[model samples]
Target: MTASMTSPDTARIAAITLTFLLAGTVKGVTGMGLPTVAMGVLGTLMLPAEAAALLILPSLVTNVWQLLAGPRLGALVRRFWLMMTGIVIGTVAAASFIAGSGGVWATTGLGAALTLYAASGLLSWHFTVPPRHERRLSPVIGVVTGLVTGATGVFVVPAVPYLQALDLKKEDLVQALGLSFTVSTVALAIGLARASAFTTTDLTSSLLAVVPALLGMWAGQRIRGHISPATFRRWFFFCMLALGLQLLLRHLI
Candidate 1:
């Protein structure tokens, strides 16, 4: 149902609008962080699965814009072919599992893992598999990430560290993330399709929320430059930590 059709609770409406605004703003500034940020915040207000479903279309659309804009697209594809291959395999495998037997335990486990990852970043601990070994290891990362995405709709964390180690330019990093998400989104769509997760109602809700999400991105872009890089990084990690804890608690209790 449309927001208006739902019982008019002014407070609830304002909260959802604000959430969408923030989600859009983050997307505009970072190009790929909206779903991560939005899901974290929205999870507090809605079911985590529902929040993730809501983000799928907008994330796909936003990332498509980035993937088309990046330079060296061909080079990126060539270099990461194995990673992509692994992601496809892993995503498909994990999607099957999710389709068959999804539950609170799986989601809670994902939340805990995400929290640990964020905490590691906060503590400045890094995991490296060495450059010479990257080819072999990269695919493993892809598989893990894909599985996480299949199960929880938040697989970006797995790729983040490896991407950071590449020392790419800021724009390239953003583009790479967008590309990564593009792959995951495709995989997710397939899974959702098989599970019959996308109903007329789901699509209707997703389409209606797109405007708010886009608006939030625009606002976030305007403010991005004003914030320091370090501050942004810290805030991102903090949000991750908070999101993880909340998810854990939700499943536990």
Candidate 2:
């Protein structure tokens, strides 16, 4: 469906704006959630493709910030190059499959991923990757992340957990996620373009949506100065759990 197929009313416009703001704030605080949260909310108001379309610019912009804010970019890239390559390849290969499966598949896949992610976070579950496995596992995890992103327009599953398992320093870890997410967003854009899900109207709306995201990111950063991110992170995951349930219900019903 095109933007012309679903004209945005005042309610949808407002919903979209607020959703991006909230998603961006979460990203600012935790270096994640712009895509997951935005899609969770926006999917309710529009076609899943349209909601995914709206994510392009905001995901790219916010994730760029997340990517660049950390230290030693060159070193990080060197470390994760094989994983990055696999992400690109997996996304490109799976895009057409997702397009054929239709949006319902994407929605369900995203919901399942969010449910698993939130449940894991809520349980405070952690995995440790043995040093021997890191070499073999990184590319596999990267490929999995790319496949999920290709289908769902959300990319915070095995990838995030895999990164956490590495036990990186706080700064390094944040930057690593940023880099992975940045790559994911770029790959998603390519996939959407090939699928013809991203149109000019969506691009315009996506660009316009960037304002709220940046403002929300700023606000979240300010809030970070005042409150503990641990609290925010807990709430964020719970909120994801709710959104995941909603998505599942919508699709199942």
Candidate 3:
């Protein structure tokens, strides 16, 4: 690999670190959102493929922490089995596809999709597909999520809104995110391995960067308790919309 491609410059490293710190803080405070925030910001600096690879380890670690910290892990697991299954299948398919053909197209598409979703959330415009006889929307969501996860390394968008629509309890939402990430990360790692994207250097860099991720998560957790849920949701959706639009514009141009 060429120096420019393999060895990210100091500015890039600095940007990644700062972004992760912010992501960690948001996730810690809200119980989830690190990848969405980080991916959107980092896409401006690095290739989408690189950003996805960089986030793998940090996302894995943070989700692990979230999963273990919860009190009713087993119950949450049971409640969201259908959702989890969809995420797993969808993520694996997406990851495999991207591993073979990673580029701006995937990133741009992901950004556009996220922007639309975030805008809907911010505007309080909900899209509901009625469950007709023999409907299978849950697995479809899972498959789409997996595909997106494979392509962009961001799987939360597909599942999050659907879960929210269900009006699941707060803890249930958190647990579902945790479970989805864990499964998606595992699929991502395998896909990366097959693609030969995980260099020794990449692994080292990811390890070194873990500190910032942890710090951000801790910071987020501390502030999360103070904010009302409605306010948090509003800010989060706004941020997602802004980031998604920024990425889409950058890639399109």
Candidate 4:
């Protein structure tokens, strides 16, 4: 390995730290944005697979914490089993091609996904999934979400929207996001490993990233009561929209 690979320069390290710090804050305030924000920022600096590799440990640890902190693990597992299964299948199926494609199209796809996510949030689009139709749609949404995760290293979009449409109580919805994100993180790790994108160095980097993430989360939590989440969310989505457009243009041009 080259010096650059073995010992990341101070500038790169600083960038990564700042990226995770901001991402963690987003998660802390919104309750679900670490991976999304991190991926978006890091994707600008590295290949999609490399960004995904850096994401594994931090995303997994935080999401697992989110999962365990919630009230209903078993119940949520039972309720979303099929969707989770589909996520695994879809992620595994797409991983090799997406993660190993040198990130040409992967970057484009990530840009597109971010754009869609930002657009949906900014528009405040809401769709209700009746209990009766949820069973049929859940697995499909899970699979699509997984595919998107595989390609972009970001796991939002259809999944979050689907969960929100379920009419779940507030706490349950948070827990559900935790569960789904945990599963997505695990599947993504496995996929990246299989693609040879996640190595020991990547693992170490990811583990270290957890610190800034948690610290940012703490800071965000401290200020959560001061700023309205809705106002923050609106601004956040707008920023994301601009970032997404930039990514798309960068890759496309």
Candidate 5:
């Protein structure tokens, strides 16, 4: 509804576009920041559920590609069934309970989650979940990850670390993240629908947002060819930390 340039809504539309562009670029280079970046910024401007709704289509599209592009898609599914089950169930349940409520708790939850994510990145913490204990720990991790996703529209944090801990090959790790995100996206959509947080307009906006995200990904890939990854990641984490702090402060105050 706010798409016109000179219709008194130019600034808002511009902000949304810029946010999506930046979110896309982050994901393009970092391979996992679209939803996190988008939600972090958008949550400041709108309800958390609305922000989550806007990311649905873009996140689904990117992660679907990420999932399909990897080796052993079927094999991976078979291997991670328990974890996947927990994620789906937890996301659905949590979202059903927390959806459409963007009060202090939601803001603080998102902020805390962001801080935790950034801290891990800042510290370069690599928690390793050994193969022997993978099955035992995965379901628990999946449930927690799903709860976080349901609450904040972010599916990384613990899930990414859990996947990283597996110590899979680099490519495999990326694919695993994709798989997990794709599933989370689907469950999130379902939960939003149940909570009346999703609407036709939101779906349309989300679909349109996919364009900027993909374009940014292309640009980011080109830029990544020129920049130092270490520098980029450090900046990314710091930025996330700052935004997290702001959110927390706003909520606490």
Candidate 6:
């Protein structure tokens, strides 16, 4: 009875680990996409709430690592403080309604986010936010991004596009992304906890998935120079686009 009952769980855990491994590798090579890819892939296997619960630990740890590894943490924080605050507010406000729904709405929203993200990548779109505009727009962008994160557990969309438009030095941009993602992850975690979605088994599974995430990152770094990031990104976005469309169609149909 024990083995029989445990079998499905064991397989599910294995699948979770592999999903993070792949997601982490993408983050390693491209410097982002961990949550987007993980949520996208896992959406196929489980409810968005369940997937969000499993995502907490690995996403938090990895984003923290990324946050600290950068050179301009202090300045990034000072500059983006308002935006982060907006993220907290927006996420907290929307969490109950969006994540708690965890049904057709959440699934459809996730699909929409993935499709938007993938479309941006595939188009190689470039946007520029001027310094004067940054102050005015950061908070708005944060709130919108948080709403999306709360709904879909993916925090890309306008936040990334806005950040990219900032015209920071490459390293600073990377660090900024880390800071934004870390804040978003923490907020999302809090929202999940408040929603009572993090069961003990799910928490353990989340913690265990961190190992595979790290391992995948290491492997991706080793192979980074050998593989063309551009080519890989094209393929990755294509896959995400297809998966996103599938999710939307599955529930709608």
Best by lDDT: 4
Predict model 2's lDDT versus the native: 0.83
In the order shown, the candidates' Cα RMSDs to the true structure are 3.0, 3.1, 3.7, 2.3, 2.2, 1.3
Cα lDDT tens digits, model 4, 1-253, are 6878756677788999999999888888889999989888888888778888888888888888889988999999999999999888888778875677745788778888899999999999999999999899989999999899988888996899999999999999999999999999999888888888788999999999999999988888887989999999998898788777877888677
Candidate 5: give its CA RMSD in angstroms.
2.2
Candidate 2 has its poorest 10 consecutive residues by lDDT at 94-103
All models: lDDT? Answer: 0.72, 0.83, 0.75, 0.88, 0.85, 0.87
Error of 4 at 240 (Å): 1.2
Residue 207 miss distance in model 3 (angstroms): 1.8
Give the Å error, residue 162, model 4: 0.3
lDDT of 2 by residue, 140-182 (tens): 9889888887877777878898999999998999899989988
* lDDT by residue (tens digit), candidate 6, 26-131: 8888888889889999999988888887888888888888889988899999999999998888876667655566567898999999998899989988988778
Highest TM-score, which number? 6
- Model 5 clash pairs are none
lDDT of 3: 0.75
Provide the lDDT at 75 for model 4: 98
Per-prediction TM-score: 0.86, 0.93, 0.85, 0.95, 0.94, 0.96
**Model 1 lDDT tens row, 1-253:** 7868676656655666677777777677656566667666766676545666676777777778778788867877777777777777777677644443676655575577568767877887666556688788779888988887777667576887777777678777777777787887777767666676655676666666677887877777787889875677678778889888978788678
lDDT, model 1? 0.72
Sorted by TM-score, highest first, which candidate order results?
Answer: 6, 4, 5, 2, 1, 3
**Clash totals for all candidate models:** 4, 0, 14, 0, 0, 0
